[model samples]
Target chain A: MDFFHVLVVLLESTIRVSVPLIFAALAGLFTERAGIFDIGLEGKMLGAAFAAGAVAAVTQSVWMGLLAAILISIALSLVHGYASITQRGNQIVSGVAINFIVAGSTVILGEAWFRQGGRTPALGEGARFQTITFPYADSIREIPILGPIYSDLLSGHFILTYVAFAMVPISWWILYRTRFGLRLRAVGENPGAVDTAGISVIWMRYRAVICCGILCGFAGAYLSLAMTAGFVKGMTAGKGYIALAALIFAKWRPFNIMLACLLFGFLDALAIRLQGNPLPLIGQVPVQLMQALPYILTVILLAGFIGKAIPPKAGGVPYVKER
Target chain B: MSTPYAKLPGWAEYGLIPLVNLAVAFLVAGLVVLLVGENPLEAAYHLINGAFGRGEYLGFTLYYATTFIFTGLAVAVAFHAGLFNIGGEGQAYVGGIGVALACLWLDQTMPWFVVFPLAILGSAFFGAAWAFLPGWLQAKRGSHIVITTIMFNFIASSLMVYLLTRVLKPLGSMSPQTRTFAEGGQLPKLDWLLAIFGLDIGTAPFNVSFLLALVAAFCVWLLIWRTKLGYEMRTMGHSPSAARYAGMSESRITVITMMISGALAGMMALNPIMGEQGRMQLDFVQGAGFVGIAVALMGRSHPAGIIPAAVLFGMLYQGGAEISFEMPSISRDMIVIIQGLVILFAGALENMFRPAIARLFAMQSRRSAVVAQTKGA
Candidate 1:
């Protein structure tokens, strides 16, 4: 392959891999921006992936699968909400518990219902999301540079990929321009201030959590329905955690989140490409190092080497009206 | 507009509440079993029988408990210092490197007794070294320990995979594991200890590590309750502001606490590498580090409580394997569900039933006061 073709292919794969991270990072943005920390994003995504895969396989309807994914993810989100928001519990512990619950339950349910050793059946073409080609893609391919960039790199992606990219601007607008977004940010920074302004901190946080659930559902559905044809056991495989790292790396901003996800996604694509290929000085790059780079970068960022990452002041602490 | 509920008695606070939480967790687990088309009572019967019916089964259960005890104590020690050390998995993973290095180096030249202590030191040193970065980051740089430790877990996993496949694996061996240990590296099984109770271990991997685990628990108890550092750790955990006012160095305590916790977590590798597997292998920690969180939560972060909690999890693990064997429909994941439920009820939603229980106690106290007043009149 020529250099241009390889670059296009790498960028295309980068977009494909980044869709889930985009959706999940945005999901975490909504939740953490409202002062509720959610480490359960991984569990929610895994649960939704299982639900989508199972429903799509059984009914052969991608729409039904999408709905089931949303419902299940929202249910898990609400459980996290109840524990952290209502019960005044430790948010981290609640998140950990939720992660464990969904991790175990999805496998148990999958095994009990499908009996495929904790996997749903492979989805048919009709049951999985189809790639959409933009208009005039075939005719435009004769042109150089811009043609392949538009047709191959930009166009011909699964619908969820477009949705994921679109969510960045929407998230930014919602979190910055809208009143709900302002209240959400306010609640996270200072719940007492939000309460004094005659807003219900509990309700605002719950709404943000619901938004998180909806976005995570898309991420999960994208995993099973768009990226792959079926749900394998542990298919999400630390993507949610990576998304969380991306969120922190982005300093919890929507545009930065998109950039962070794409950067990580690019690293992932490079890792896959460089599996056996040797570079000039480094010799063959170990795939494990590539896989571990996102985490290492995140840890370094968390250590404030690059820049400081300050979470919401009220984050992880349950609000009490009387106290 | 509202009256405060009465304080629970000591038994209810520590004992009764946890028992109720455990009962609720099991009830939910039973419901899950029923959903899977199995009789819950029969499954429970089989689970109990599987854990204790045979001497070998009991031996296996205790063997599993040995690993949990070390990890649990690791988490509990960190908990006492107000740090959540979830990187136990990673710590233990790297700890295997220390163990493998010690065994590989000294097994041929030194006696088993001499090699054992060196291996312990090696494992603790490596594990503590693994944790020191996250700890220092948390203490000095103001980073969240939870996030850093979690990141460390991924880093450790990647590092171990690379090491095992490229560096540690024997030249002729295709598998991603070290060469099997020599006789000096292997821990002797505790068949004689079982013989005192007129039982045969019968192929169980139960070994001297179990005794070491018990000794570690006792040491943890003494350290937490009797030592000056222990008092400082508890003060830090309960109220950091107060600890600061009392002239305690926050950064020093945080780093020391994490290193100690890491060392305990690192020692958990001894059970599997020295006792059971007899070599360093990929993923030998086997989610034991995460299980430490559940154990520590259930145990209320006390050494006394941690022992029983670890054994309970050990029962669940051994019995769950038996259940999966007996009833094909019910897989080992059921134990995971129970564990999640236990952590949920005991750790996060611990106050779910507290209000009702407190009200009940308040009513009883009021009734007693009224009766005493009436009799006096």
Candidate 2:
């Protein structure tokens, strides 16, 4: 392959790997920006992935599968909100609890419902997301640089991938321009201030958590329905945690979150590409090390080798008006 | 509005509340079982029987408990220092490296007594070293311990895989594990100890590691409650500024607390490596380190409390294993849900019903007072 083709392939692979991460990062961005620590994002995504796969397998409709995934994710988010928000419980513990619950329930339910080694049946066309081609994709193929860029980089992506990237701009706009976004940010930093302004801190947090759930739902669906044919056990893996790291790396900003997710995505893509290829001097980097690179980098970033990451002022502290 | 239970009579606060929470958790678990179309009572019976009915099963339960005790104590120690060391899983994983190296080196020539101590030291040293970086980062750079520790877990997993496959795997062996340790590397089973108690428990994986776990617990209690460093850790946990004001260095305490926690978590390898597996392998720590969080929370971060909590989890694990075998419909994941429910109720939603319970007590007291006044009148 030529240099340009290799570059296109790498970019395409990065985008593919990044879609789920983008969704997970977006999911975390909403919740953490609203001041809720959402370590349970992994569990929620896993649960949603299983639900989507199982539902899509049964109904043979990707849309219904997406709906089921979103509904389940939202239910989990509400549970997190109830424990951490309304109940004024320990946020980390609540998130951890949600993680365990979903991790367990999904497998149990998946086994009961599908019995295919804790996986749903392989999804056929109409049940799984189909790649969408841009208009005039054939005409654009001979257009040189722009042609390959359009066809390889932009076109032939699962519809959900486009939505994942599109949601980045949408989230940025919602977080920066909208009143709900402003209130959500304020609630996270200073819920007391929001309450004094006659707004419901509870409601604002709830909305943010709901948005998180929706994004996580898409992320999970994209994993099982688009990225793969079915939900295997622990399909979300550590993407949720990686997304949280990306959130912190980006200082919880939507645009930066997108960049952070892509960076991680690129790392994963590179790992996949370099699996068997040995380099000069350094020889072949172990696949395990490559898989672990993002985490090690996250630790470095968190250690302030990059820059200080200041969380929302009132992030883990529960808001209590009476106190 | 809530004066009735005021302090909940100390016993009720610490003792009764946890019991109530566990009861509620079990109730929820039963409900889930019912939802899954199985008779909750039947499942519970099988679960309890499978865990404790046979001597061999009891041995397995104790074997599981030994690891939980170590990890739970590790988490509890961190909790006392106001740090959440979520990297126990990672610490334990790297700890396996220390275990393998120690066993491989000493097993050929040394006796079990000498090898055992060296093995324990090796595990703790490696595990503590694994945790030292994150602890140092948290202290010096203000990095969040939870996130850093979590990231370290992924790093540790990858590192272990590389080491196991490329470096440690026995030559000409396709398995991703080292050769089984020499006899000197193995810890003797506690069958004799069981016999001393008049119990005819069959020889099982339960071994001297259980005794080591018990000793570790006692030592932790002493360290936390009796030592000056423990007092410093507790002070820092309660109020860092105050600790700083009192001439306690926050950074030092944080680092030292994490090291100690890591050491405790590392000790967990003894049971799996020396007592059972007799060799180093991948993912032996499993989720025990994570489960330790729930154990510490349920145990109120006390060693005395941690023992029973650890045992309870051990029962759950062993019972769940048996359940998966007996009831193929209920996958292994169901145990995770049960564990999750217990953690949710006992830790996160711990205070959800506290005020309501307190209110009920208050109302009863008020009614009793009124009755007393009427009788006098």
Candidate 3:
């Protein structure tokens, strides 16, 4: 491909790969904003993906499957919230347990129910998301650079790509402008202060966790229904953790999170494209090197190799009533 | 006036929580079995029997326990240093690689006496070196150890996958594993010792690794309990500022602690490669490092305490395998549920039961004070 064609493909690939991460990153933002640390995003997303894929396969309806995934992910989030918040348990341990539970249980159930080792039967096109086209942009293919870029690169993404982009703005507005957002930030910073002002800390945290669950549900749907047409064992492959790192790298800002997600998505897309492609200049980098790009980025970002990023003051510390 | 009977002494205060934690853990595990449509009683019976019912199985349990003890100590050491070394899995892989390379490349030329110790040392060195980068980042750059170590794990696993698949495969085998080590590289099993107790059984895989594990545990206990360095680690884990004020080198301690933990984790591969496989395999150290976290938590991060905890976990692993065979319908995931519950209960009850005990003590003291005051008045 020529330079312009390569550029268009890169841009298109970036948007496609970034959609699920954007949803998951926004999910992390919602939980962490409300003063909760959610390392369980990966588990919730995987659980929902499995649930959505299996349900959609059986029901032959994508919407119903997506709804089911949302409900199941929310239930798992409740388990996480209750264990960490209600029982005064360690958030990390609770999150890790949720991951193991969902991972092991989903595979076990899949094998028992469908006689598949850890996968659901792939769904037909109608049962999965269809590519959404902007017809006007398609007609503009005759125009110069902007038209070609917009029409050729961006016009035929899955429906969820638009939604993932839209979520960034909605997340920004909700976190920065609303009364609930203020309370969420306040609670995260200091639950005692929020409680003294007559707000219930428990209820607020539950709301944050639920909001997180809903967003993660969408992320799961995007993965199972939009990105790929089915579920496989450990298909998430640590994307949730990558999203979590993106949350920190972005300093928990929605806009920054969007940018961070795009950067990671670009690297991921580049890696995928680079695989099995003979690049004349660089010779051949092992596929494993490309797979490890995001993690390497996370360690670099975490090491303050970029700049300082601070977490919420009360993150991971569950509120306990004092006598 | 006498101290109130309601209050537990210090030992009971520390000891009772773990027992209660164990009870709650087993109860939760039993409930999970029920959820999976198995008879909880029968499953539990099989679990216990599978672990300790036969002499051969018991040897397997001990062998499994050896790995846990090493990894658990590795985790506990870092825990004492107030560092979380999630890279144990990766470090262990590096250690395995080191042993494999030494055996494959060097064993032909070296004497058995030199090759064996060199293999152990090589494993430890690789593990320590693998951990050192993250430790350096954590100390020098203020990177969070949890994230850094986790990243290292992915890198390590990816590297191993590449090596096993493309680089390290034995000629003509195309399989994702290594060549069998030369005889000089193998560790000798203690069949005669077990035979003296009339319990020698199994396929001669049981070896001196168990003794090495216990000795490592004892050494760690000594390092933590008797030495100034151990005291500093414990203090630093509790509070960095306080440790620094007390003259501990934060950076030095971080690096040293992670290296030691990594070395200990690497030692685990010695058992499997030198004891069982006589070579490295793809399925080597599958999640044992992660399981070590649960073991360390359940053991309350104590060396002495970790022994029983490792044994408990080893039993669960062995029995989990056996139970899966007997009841093919129930997925082996029932073991993970049990493990998750054990970690949950142990973590939760540590904070939960402490205050409850304190309250009981306070109430007893108040009652005694009231009696003493009335008698005096």
Candidate 4:
């Protein structure tokens, strides 16, 4: 392949890998910005992925699967919200329980329903997400840098890829422009003040977590339908956690969260490229080294580079009625 | 109609909580069996019988307890320091690998006694080192230990997968594992000691490791309650600012607390590595480190409490594994459901039941009081 071909391949792969993370990061942004720590995002996404894939496989309708996935995700989110919000239980412990629940339950159910032993049957073409190519992109495919980048990176991805990118702007608009956004931030920063202003702190948190659920549903759908075309055991593979890291790195800003996702996505893309193909100079960087990139980046960012990425003051501290 | 039961102190509080906790634990375990459409009584019978009915099985259960004791204590120690060390998996993996490597390298050349202690110590060092980084970051840079510890778990598991498959390939097999250790690397079995207690060591794999775990637990209790450092750790756990005001370096305590936690977790490999297996392999401890959190929680995060909690888990784990073999359709995941329920109830049910019980007793006493008042009138 020519230099252009390699670049085009690289660009497309980057977009593909980055989409789920974008959704997850944005989901995390909503929850954390509202001042709730959601380490359970991974569980939510996995549960959604399994639900979506199983529904799609059985119904042979991608739309039905997507809807089911979102509903299940929201249900699980409500579980987290109820435990951490209503009961004043420890959020971290609740999240951990949810993780264990999802991990074990999905596999158990998957094996029972499909008999494939913790994996769903593959989707037929009609049931899988079809690529939505940009019209006339072929005509501009011959053009220089911007044209190649656009066609390779931006065009021809599954519909959700566009949605994932579009979400950043939408998230920014909602977080900054809307009254709900203000209330959400206020609740996160100080629920006591929000309550004093006569708003229901509980309602604001519920809404924030609901938004998180919807976004996580899309993230899970993107993983099953768009990214892998089928669900595998533990297939989300800590991307949810990585997205969480991105959200923190971005300091809870939607746009910065997107950027963080892309950076990690690029590292992942590079890792995959390096995997099976040895470099001419370094004789193939070890797969282990490549795999460690995102974690290494996360550690560095968390340690110092992103100075004072302050969590919402009320984050993870469940708001009690009397307190 | 009446106020809640007055709070008690001394042994009454200490003795009652665990008894109540165990009763609740068993009740939930029975409910799970019922949910699965099985006979609760029979299942409980089988569960107990399967775990301890056979001498070999009983030995395995105790050996399992040895692993739980170590990891549970590790989590308990961290809890005392107000740090949740979810990186126990990583610490255990690193420690396991270290011991395996030590055993492989030192077995033939070194004396049996020297090699065994060195292997255990080497593993502990590796575990402590693994935990040190996250602790240091939390102390020095204000990074959250939760995320970092989780990331480290992924790194450790990935590295382990890679090393086992590629680097540490056994003598001739392509499968993912190292060679079994030499006899010298194995933990010494006190056959005579077991004989004195009228127990056989041959089938049990019950060795010095169990005693070591008990000693470790006792030491942990002493460290938390008796030592100055323990006092500092407790203060830091309660309030970092208070600790600082009291002349404790919060950063140093954080790092040292994690190291202690890591070292305790490191000792867990002794069960699988130096026990019957005498090898490092896949699913060696099998999420015991994570389960340790539940043990710690159930035990109320104390060294003394953790022993019973560890034994409780060891029983469930043994029972669950045995059931999976017979109930092919049920899958081993029934254990996960039971575990989740245990945790849910362990954390929530106490809060729920205490009030209801107090109300029940209050009504009975109030009725008697009304009768007395009427008679007096």
Best by lDDT: 1
Task: List candidate 3 segments past 4 Å from native.
Answer: A1-3, A57-60, A124-127, A136-152, A190-198, A320-323, B1-12, B110-113, B170-173, B348-377
**Model 1 agreement with the true structure over A1-323: per-residue lDDT tens digits:** 39899899999999999999999999999999999999889989998999999999999999999999999999989989998999877788888887888788888889999989899998998999999999999889768999999899888999899899899999999999999999999999999999999999999999999999999999999999999998888899999999999999999999999999999999999999998999779798899999999999999999999999999898888888974
lDDT, candidate 2, at A135 = 93
**Residue A276, model 3: Cα distance from true site in angstroms:** 3.1
Q: Residue A229 lDDT in model 2?
A: 95
> Residue A111 lDDT in model 2?
77
Error of 2 at A320 (Å): 0.9
Please give the TM-score for the first chain of candidate 2: 0.96
Worst 10 residues of 4 chain A by lDDT: A86-95
* lDDT of candidates 1 onward, in order: 0.92, 0.89, 0.82, 0.80
Candidate 2: where are CA atoms >4 Å away? B1-6, B367-377
Scored against the native two-chain complex, candidate 1 gets a DockQ of 0.83
Q: How close is candidate 1 to the true structure, as a TM-score?
A: 0.98
Best by TM-score: 1
Tell me the tens digit of each residue's lDDT in model 4 across A260-320: 8988888788888878888887786778777777777777777987576777889987786
lDDT of 2: 0.89
- Residue pairs with colliding backbones in model 2 are B4-B362
Superposed by TM-score, candidate 3 places the C-alpha of residue B275 at a distance from the truth, in angstroms, of 2.5
Candidates 2 and 4 compared: the better one by DockQ is: 2
Off by over 4 Å in 1: B1-6, B375-377
For candidate 1, write residues B1-377 as lDDT tens digits. Answer: 12233579988987888889899999999999998899999889889888888889888999999999999999999999989998999999998888999999988787778878888998999999999999999999999999999999999999999999999898988999999988889989998988898888999899998998999999999988999999999999998999999999999999999999999999999999999989999999999998999999989999889999999999999988999899999888888888888888888888889999888888999999999999999
Q: Which ten residues in a row have the lowest lDDT in candidate 3 chain A?
A: A108-117
